[model samples]
Target: MSLELRSVNYPRRISLMRNNKSRLSGFTLWEVLVVLFLMGVLLTSFTPYYGSASKHVRLQMNRANIQRIEGAAQLYKIDVGTYPHSVTDLVYSQKGMSDWQGPYLNEIPSNPFNSEQSYQLDSSGRVNNSSAN
Candidate 1:
């Protein structure tokens, strides 16, 4: 009976192990690109709704500010016997207005729609947004 021992091919075994390790290691380029594409699509799809939601919030804040100004004006009228001539009058004393009891508001709130402009006091003693027209 004869016993035979064969030499192992070490380089070939190493090469095969490396190949298998690479295949199982990480995501392929195509998979990463697909995930990025899907994320971009989701962001684009939600962008318009996000913008409208923020605008809706601004509109609601505008309405609330107008209501606050209206309430202050009513208080001013009760004290001074007339509506304020301007929004500034609510936060400062006016000349020749002896009945003035204000500083009704801490400060005049800027118009939400247009930050550069202040809220308008209409001829009817109502508060409005000039930029809205």
Candidate 2:
């Protein structure tokens, strides 16, 4: 008998075609590469701003440390009647000041910008310092 297989095969073939089209509907390789390049460009533009912000934060920390050291020195002077000859003297006993109450700071802090460089105090107890980096 002559059977009409055309109708049955046509519907299956159409469905298969539709599925293939749907699978291919997403982004192509060129489109994905373009998106990645744009993102790189956007991030690079903000790099300078991030660099300057970090430097500013380091400088602020150094200034705050100097202020703290100066305050502790002033307190030591008030109690003992003169500024200590060095920063360590603030945290340790000198010779014979029975009234000395100190260890003013738990420990000396190094410069934030340069760990190898310690803060300097002038006759006036100001911080003038250098950085290794």
Cα lDDT computed for each candidate against the true fold:
0.83, 0.78
TM-scores of all candidate predictions against the true structure = 0.76, 0.74
Error of 2 at 52 (Å): 1.0
| 1 Cα displacement, candidate 2 (Å) | 9.8
Pairs that collide in candidate 2 are none
For 1-133, candidate 2 gives per-residue lDDT tens digits of 1346887788999999999999899998999999999999999999999999999998888877888788988888778877767677767887888767897777887787878787666666555554312
Model 2 scores a C-alpha lDDT of 0.78
Residue 76 miss distance in model 1 (angstroms):
0.7
